[model samples]
Target chain A: GQQVMQIPQYQHVQEGEDFTTYCNSSTTLSNIQWYKQRPGGHPVFLIQLVKSGEVKKQKRLTFQFGEAKKNSSLHITATQTTDVGTYFCAGPPHRFNKFYFGSGTKLNVKP
Target chain B: EAGVAQSPRYKIIEKRQSVAFWCNPISGHATLYWYQQILGQGPKLLIQFQNNGVVDDSQLPKDRFSAERLKGVDSTLKIQPAKLEDSAVYLCASRRVRRDGNYNEQFFGPGTRLTVL
Candidate 1:
């Protein structure tokens, strides 16, 4: 069975500190997506990486995809209270439309 | 634009009791998905529907779980004789289909949390 694994199941950081979560897949993927879920809220789409070795940034967040398309990472600089949430990386198994989600990394930002 | 919609934000039932969840995807979206998210975990795909047809349900427990999307719009998921392990949040998501095989972002609805005792 194919699986997406995320490391650092739980991370607590000071508001001004940096944080990162890594996602690795058992099989190569055609594309990968990142999502965030605030406590008690639904998961919201944040970004997607399609090309191998792609790197995209959104404000303080930086996303990177492995050259082999088997891993990805999300890094947040200067974490804020609003950054408290669970981050998940999802990838399809050689297809589009269906996804296998990572176990997710829960982040707790303390001020 | 309106987001996906789910009913009965929360549910509580004893083991062996039957339960059903309803979901309405965004307008004009042709792909809908049902997922189960246990506390502290990510959402797991239970079933996926491309319009009125099922694309994949390999992960669904066929003996106890069933889903339908008759009009290719709103959908429902039912679990009969539920077990204590069935406790989790059910999330419904939708996305527009692209002909170019490009992946699209999924819009999720506020999930229905189920607590089985």
Candidate 2:
């Protein structure tokens, strides 16, 4: 079975600070996706990284995929109050139909 | 376009009771998934359906949990003789078919929060 390990189970930062969460999988993944879940809300798809050593950005957030295709990271620059939520990394193993999710990194930004 | 739909946003039941949750995915989406999220934890895949047939349910507890998607449109998840540990939020998600074989975008419904005492 494939599994993903996420670092910094919890993160607390000032409103203008930065935050990052790392995800490492036990097996190589075809692609990886990131999701955000707000308090008392359902998880929402954020972005996906495919290709080795790929990097993508959305406004102040950046996502990166390791060259090995088994690790990923999400970094938020100058985080704001709205950035407070749990971030999850997920993906399916090669040649598998099911997707496995990381334990998640909860972020709390103080305004 | 309408997003995924779920019923009874919240549920409370005693241990040993049975409870069911319903989900209606987005129109024309070919993939639907059910996930369980405990307090302070990320969502775990419980079952996944490709159209009306199950794609995978390896993480589901067969002794008490079961799910079905009839007519390939609507789905339901049932838990019989629920235990206190069954307390969690059940989320339903759907994704449109991609010709490129990449399923990276998924729309989620407001999950059903279950509390078993």
TM-score per model over all chains: 0.98, 0.98
Over B1-117, each residue of candidate 2 has an lDDT whose tens digit, in order, gives 999999989999999999999999999999999999999888899999999999999999999999999999999999998999999999999998899987768899999999999
Off by over 4 Å in 1: none
The lDDT per prediction is 0.95, 0.94
The sequence of per-residue lDDT tens digits that candidate 1 reaches over residues B14-114 is 99999999999999999999999999889999999999999999999999999999999999999998999999999999999989978789999999999
Residue pairs with backbone atoms closer than 3 Å in model 2 (clashes): none
Q: Which stretches of candidate 2 lie over 4 Å from their true place?
A: none
For model 1 chain B, the run of ten residues with the poorest summed lDDT = B97-106
Candidate whose lDDT is highest: 1
Model 2 C-alpha RMSD vs. true structure (Å) is 0.8
Question: lDDT at B27 for candidate 2?
Answer: 99
Model 1 lDDT, full chain set: 0.95
When candidate 2 is compared with the true two-chain complex, its DockQ is 0.89
